[model samples]
Target: MTDFTHMELELEAILHASNDNIIVTDDKGIVLRAIKNSEEFYGEPSEKMIGKSVYELEKMNVFSPSVTRKVLEEKGEVRLLQKTASGKTVMAKGIPVFNSDQQIVRVISLSHDLTEIQQLKEEYEKLQSKVERYESEIEKLKKRETPLDELKTKSPIMRKAQETLKRVANSEATVILFGESGVGKTLFARAIHRESDRHLQPFIDVNCGAIPASLAESELFGYEAGSFTGASQKGRMGLIESADGGTLFLDEIGELSLDIQVKLLKVLQEKEITKIGAVSSRKVNFRLIAATNQDLKKKVQEGTFREDLYYRLHVIPVEIPPLRERKEDLPMLSERFLHQFNSKYGKQTTLHPETLAKCLAYSWPGNVRELENVMERLVIMSDQPVISPQLLLLDSSQTDEPQPWMGIESFDHQGKTLKEVVLEIEQNWLLRAVKEGRSTYEMAKKLGTSQPTVVRRLKQLQSDSK
Candidate 1:
């Protein structure tokens, strides 16, 4: 009837106006009809989409198992997650339409774009990962551990640091790396240099502590040809001059004397350095990366370090944590070192579960450097394919062992030889230290001795007579 046909046309038009994407396909999976909403969703005209295969429009569906033509033959209904050409996620539901003979004639599919929802989800996950990563990274940084090497966790820490570095790389601001020793301050300085626009220019590193007071000025600002008795005939380029249009890393900057600090502050403020015995000053266009393990605030309070210089260098303070606080990263760091040492030592040695457990238990006082050395030693000295605590000579070293000295005395102490008594004490301490995750430095500090002394004592104890 004319009335029935009019009603059907009206219904189709209403469905086409709906926000959901509506598509009609023949039983063979060929697109037969597409609603106006579908045209909007696919960013394609309805006329073009009607004649094309739905699979042809979606390219990323090759790996999906739900979009096959066999689904229409086997199942009367199917639901799947699909992505559009523009990488937008969409949820699609398909249902078979039956004819008068109770046989499937066409399949009607409705789609709802989930791009915004999925993007929100992804953003939330990224934020959560960043929070965890920074927390982990800050903890690791405090302990002189590189999150990249230790946790291998990708978050926004390094990315943000890189961005910050970019923002200030060309500026003349003094960037002081406030971190513990062995925290890769020099590497970060190099990174800043490499990322700067002056990447091709010279990059020089000067250890302020290593230079003598008499030579510090000449070494930094250069000297005239006949400045001193031992000076070269031709004036040599100092670190500052060598770093022209580039970067200079002044490591252990806290060790600089008051006079040098004053002169350095002047150079930073004036953007010029006067060489020793030079009548004139040379304008230096370079970035300064100052690193120090000492507490500048305390040094300032003690009147040893200049407050103005401290403020100048503290413009962008990058603090690096030591290794003990980022214990969660020990496993990854250990594995990396294991792999590296395995290759370097020409051994296929793998860490034993117990040894790994010990490594995690021990606090990394010296951070990555210490961990690398320990792994190298283990790989070289270990005999078995897999390293075990027994092979590490850790029976007396607390590298792996449980402590039971809280309450009762288990070992016999009566009439024991002096060596035996010392051995028992060492064993107990080592066990306790392992449980506490105390590094050699911590133990040495607590026992009032240097790290080398503690190491020597541990080695001697390991070689004790059983």
Candidate 2:
């Protein structure tokens, strides 16, 4: 080829090199040449495609009216959407290739794949759904505002906890949820049940403390029609029976009397329950999840909770740290609650950064429940969009102004000794790590230590803090 012809050829190659799939075909629709991606998208050998009718490909669906045929008949160009063999959607533009005499020589089709467009569409739909949910939640908030809905937490600790829940959700082992009251233990338990294999089945929640001593046993195990004087005409199935093949969440298990604890232990061991005033024993299959604000170990030692039951429930122990422990989550929780309250009140609202900082600084005695209540009150009462710290009622009496946890020390005065301060900081970090649900492996990797050493230190920190 001459220099000018070589330059023309190089330019043609660069133009064709554009990522779009290029298929050159004759007037009869025979594929004369195809780009590399054409083979990938169509799952066909490009070399073999030569001399073969392009419309014969499964994706092209031979009889279908397409841009290729349109360009050939009109002796012009046409654009249309097309599908590839890999189920990929594409936008194809077909232009008639003409000779110097103006005779149609072939057709050059440019295929622009719609992979990114489809992904963007999906993302848009997701964001739209989220916006709708936010609007709906706002409307609900305006009606009868509940503090629970206002709960927002984005702390790494909370994230790790959610991650762990997702991991063991399919397991059948008994789960003991340890946390202070108002820490949303029941919420976590319900979330787990919803994500578990028994999602379709009933999730019966039993507040052991709420159930009367007289009716507790019958309510849990159920009674026959004539088992008790007040029994219904039809035999009543107990909570245990109702939760068959599902999950039975026992809240405040520490409150269950020793006698009842014995019966619960038997059910856990034997996988069966005998109803009050009933002769026959019925087999039951249900996962057990127990939660408590009280110290279960102390209860066991006090001759209240049975040791066997404690061990059984403690198999998959999940200790939820108090709100004060996971201080980092406070801002997220506050913001979430603000959004929830904003929707309900039909008012645009936001939290002042300073006000939120005070909330995080304050030692939450009542845990998450307390924070939720405070946020709810702020939402309902505050006329301004931004909630201020003054609304929280954190006076000097309520909290230490200068030093929240400890009294302010003089510059010359010795407050906490060097050892005490170091120990306190260490305890706080260790507690924070544990509260964040850092596994032994994860903690070791982060702390630059072996797993065993991390585990040993964590146990020691917990003990020392206690």
Candidate 3:
């Protein structure tokens, strides 16, 4: 053979040996050539495909949306996904050949099967979804475990409280947390919610006293669009409705008005709420955790709080002892706060012995929150690594004095009888003891009396004042 014939035979051999399916068509969309692999990918022999019109093959279901036809119509290169009669998916690209006048002369089509790659991509997506689901479940488990872990305490009373909380954590019973202001009632409420089965849901907290009386009803029960003057055009969902399938925490619940109390009672009883200016009531499902520093029983007797509502909320009551009652936990609580603030402010500071002594001695009327704030202030403002007692902003004159008659001396008792004078003195002493101490036990210790004596005297004092 001649050199030109040898080169043509070599080129044909290379084209036929290619793994990719190759097809060549004339400008009129008739197949001029096809590779041997066409039989494998298109379920047709190369000799049969040759000399056939692409439109006829497409009509015969050999392959879909002929790539040669696309290149001919667009007069340019085209790329697309194609499915063959053999059910093989492919990535097909069509290239157009132009003559000297820039007119279409021939079309070359190349295709790569993507069936295996597509299957792998689908498998990867499924694995990714499973991993995401596992991560979400792990996060929920951590949340459920951390609430009780976060309650760091060494006091017997606090340990008992935690045990009680653990016992009722899984129950759907309404919880009432009673304590002095700043005694971590809100924290305990949140802990109870987190440890419950509803931890994955939202935790909605509303300070009943913080909301205005004018807006309390609408804020708790929601309102329809244009229900009242200045109402939002889109309407608003109430705090109770928004907490559905979650925990609704009402802090300072005693501050709600009597009218709102009645409505809240209905929600607790019926598990439903009605929006303002709406005819229908929507059912709501949620765990209720209410907190208050005031005496709800006293409020009930005085007609300020509803009696039936108080009982409903008083289910599984959790009384958080004040800081003074649990003074043994001070060191641990203080150290925890110090570590927290150190990490926050990037400081390595230690409290002085005298500082801790002063902290333990002073009556923390504001409870744990007060100590936390003081520690944060010391961490931020102190110039040295060792915090001293002087760094604590507690007033010595207010806390160090032992006289119960400090403020009483300023009152006018000159014209009072001796009997009245002695009665005033007794009342002043009782009040001072109660104010300085945490509970009746602590008050009795300070007054050199029994806990029952302190309780009885305080009860009498409360009655006399009323």
The order by descending lDDT is 3, 2, 1
Clashes in candidate 3: how many? Answer: 0
Tens digit of lDDT per residue, candidate 2, span 4-45? 999978855964688887778887988877775556656666
Q: What are the per-residue Cα lDDT tens digits for candidate 3 across 1-466?
A: 9999999888678778887789999999999888887988898899999999999999988889789989999999999988899888888999999999999999999988987897798789867865675466456546433486578775668988999998998899988889999999877877887789998776778999999999999999999999999999868789898788888999999999999999999998899999999899989999999999999999999999999999999899888999877665676778878988999999998776446656755768899899999999999988999887688879655353344444447555667797876766676676566556645677788779988887676545433432
Question: Each model's TM-score, in the order given?
Answer: 0.51, 0.53, 0.56
Where does candidate 1 clash, by residue pair?
141-320, 141-321, 142-321, 142-322, 143-321, 143-322, 143-323, 144-321, 144-322
Better of 1 and 3 by lDDT: 3
The regions of model 2 sitting more than 4 angstroms off are: 1-160, 395-466
- C-alpha-based local distance difference test score of model 1: 0.69
* Model 1 agreement with the true structure over 1-466: per-residue lDDT tens digits: 6999999899788777877777778766677877865544666677776776655655434213334353575756778887665456788777888888877778887777899999899789867955664465345335432322222422134434555666776666778877777656776776666556665565677899999998888888888898899999867667777677777789999999999898989998998988888899989888889999899999999999999999888888876665554443455666777877788778897665446546656656666677777888888888889787765543334233444554226555577787866665664565455455455666566556676765565444333311
Q: Candidates' lDDT values, in order?
A: 0.69, 0.71, 0.83
- The numbered model that scores best in TM-score is 3
How many steric overlaps are in each model, in order?
9, 5, 0
TM-score, predicted candidate 3 vs. hidden true structure: 0.56
Q: What TM-score does prediction 2 earn? A: 0.53
